[model samples]
Target: MATCCFLSSSILRHPSHTTPLQGRLQTRRNFSFFKITAIFWGPKKTTTPTTRSMMDVSLGTFTLIGSPEQKPPVEPKELQQVSISVVSSISNVSSIDWDACAVDANGQGIFNPFLSHAFLSCLEESGCAVQETGWLPQHIIAQDENKNTIGVVPLYLKSHSYGEYVFDHSWADAYYRFGYQYYPKLQSCVPFTPVTGQRILVRDAWYKDQVIDMLISALKDLALKLQVSSLHVTFPTETECQRMKKDGFLQRTGMQYHWKNRNYKNFDDFLMDIKQSKRKNIRQERKKISAQNLTMKRLRGYEIKDKHWDSFYRFYRNTTDSKWGQRYLTRDFFHNMGSKMGDNVLLIVAEEDDKLIAGALNLIGGDTLFGRLWGCLPQAYYPSLHFEACYYQAIEAAIELNLSKVEAGAQGEHKVQRGYMPVATYSCHYIVDEQFRNIISDFLVHETKQMEVVMKMMQDSGPFKDGLE
Candidate 1:
């Protein structure tokens, strides 16, 4: 016979309306029938063991509590049983299983290459995201009774928030002011990536909802056990944001520039949609490349070579060093990504006199082209080269591949004048301390409204001809 279990009962309140931590005690109940088993880390586990009694509610979530001597918790009939474990690396799980959870999470064939096992593993294998760099992998995996992978969450115990595009330095500063350490907080995101997608990877099983709920519960429990300052899930889908909000996470909104393709036949058709000035400006920029005697090539799969990776890495280092930005990605990362995900990798290179001078890196998605990194050789300034390599070329590639849009990376208002319009990106935060949670919640409320206004303003000012808005 199958086992039934009661997950946990805790008050689920909207973050904004909740009372101060000292004043309220409320409980909300959800039912599951899966046997929930949790594995503890360290010599002596700090997390509370499973038990039958109602767990204490800590800031609107269940805080685990029990001694080994306590009787095993009763399995509530209505609850679905799940087993969750933490792996120090993504390599611990098979790629097929991990990819299954990632791509089939929503029952739709939603594919995000960034979240794929191959891409994430490359980050680890290349040493770009590792304990040494402060992105220690502490991924959460959920499984059903049959031992099938039901869900996974790409999580990390971050020592600092550098690569995550969602800015939280203010929160860190606030923590320091209060004499609290914030470096080792838990984060769920594609390191250095800001594109929105599902962070909680759950398969389209009958128990997907339960697994998601369980994963969130387990995340909170682990945070308490590890005693981290908070848990942040960045760049999750809008639907995921709403679900997380219901579970007490503070919702945040930000913007990115994206160029949407409206079934254009070619680059010329795309240009026609924009205003005459913008179209002429783009044509003029394209002319600069030809005037400089530069040749542009879009290399994919085996067409990209080791020499190209080396050149791109140099360009990347130069770009980052000039800006005083940390070189978070190592040389090996580029080679590894090319080897593992070559088909999905697109490298746009500008060649002059048979020598590569600059390059832009992008990863092809199911229907979107993600523009990630771009760099040029030192003192090799060609007129409008940056615009050509990064923006126009990407748009042309998208048109040729018939992809949906080009999600140029974060925070560039200039993209608006080039037909890329502002779109909202989301993140959700869970603050362990109640006071801080309320403070952040209030700030997000204001920030969200401001973001909405900015998005509308950007759309109005977009390069597209008037009726397009």
Candidate 2:
């Protein structure tokens, strides 16, 4: 019989010790499924080989509270009623409700329908994200009583972590030392995106925990059943981390810099927020570019035509060719994005002597704007052209659009001095091998603590008069 269970809190009066395998669940709403497996964490023994195979894919409930300034604690809880079903493809799910979970509180962030059926369909249709590309989409969606989506996680059964920003090369090396395989790991993340948003999209705070617990459990079980190396959830919220921690997932911390709008009224207000030295240097950079008879223009939505993509792709090709062995996005992909995503896209191009010298492409979200790709012609000698095309133009547009933040992409201490604040990102891990898991867990504890300390120190060293205050 298919059953549904409702849990309001974490007051676990009856939990199993050892490993929880198959358990009976009480439900309010009737849900249909081909198979049913539930695990509640407590102090009872219920471990079996078959049970282990199924239970490995389940997770219990937990919580994460507070902000970067103050660390909070998580109270332990058990999952009430969870239904786990595996689909053969992402096409089975609707992208509309699945993507709705990504809508931020602000109305100005990018609502990329890429995770949608049409987009994922395009990837599968275009052969962009497939076995050949090492990206196998294995999306997971959880629904409640009315069959409305409660949560959806865009997952990939990745053979390599090339596009993922979170580096696990060190962990892989350590595993190899002990004679283990780390390839063919399960990844729950947005493909080729390091921008911070809801990786696991759920409704309210209560349903959020429930849906997250469900995903964690399913991934673990899939790892064991498929005999894969590990399960990774990248760039999740700190609140998501608390639930993951309670479910026994290893946590890792990463850093990315984002510029926030501080009632900046305009561009000059933003420049004044940075340190004086940085402010002067930026002014000089802007001035130098202005002196070169270069004109910069921002084209959004339908304003960008097919010919624009041709020039932009050429610039993109030049940028990638300059790198020793950099991977390049196909020309078709860029054209497709601009075509499919209108108004949501922005192209900042620099023109000099009636020729396109540099360009940067950004995906504009509701409250946030993301800098994704950039390129420049070698002959264009506009000073600080890269910064202007990528950063300055983005800041100006974000302000003009009244966006709350502009994420400048990854890795830069330099970005800190440029008025971008440091923010900590998170990833959750589950290693199959016990020995390796323990070693990694120890590493995480130390790593997380160090990250906390560094975040505070960076806050203290922030340039703005009222920055950390």
Among these predictions, the greatest lDDT belongs to: 1
**TM-score, candidate number 2:** 0.76
Candidate 1 TM-score to native: 0.83
The local distance difference test score of each candidate is: 0.79, 0.65
Q: What is the lDDT of residue 47 in candidate 1?
A: 24
Overall local distance difference test of candidate 2: 0.65
**Error of model 1, residue 36, in angstroms:** 45
User: For model 2, how does the per-residue alpha-carbon lDDT over 262-302 read when each residue is reduced to its tens digit?
Assistant: 76778888877777877888888888787988899999989
> How many Å off is the CA of 263 in candidate 1?
0.5
Identify the runs in model 1 with alpha carbons over 4 angstroms from their true place.
1-80
Best candidate per TM-score, number? 1
lDDT of 1 by residue, 1-469 (tens): 2221111112332333433221111111221121112111222112222212112212222212222333553345423446787888899889999999999875687678999999999999999998889888888888755667778899888888899877777676656555557668899999988888899999876556766888888888877777787999999999999999998899988788899999988999999999999889989989999999999999999999999999999999999999847898989999999999978999999999999999999999999999999999987789999999999999999999999999997766778888888888899999987766766676565556546655776687778887895
Measured over all alpha carbons after superposition, the RMSD of each candidate to the real structure, in angstroms, is 13.4, 15.0
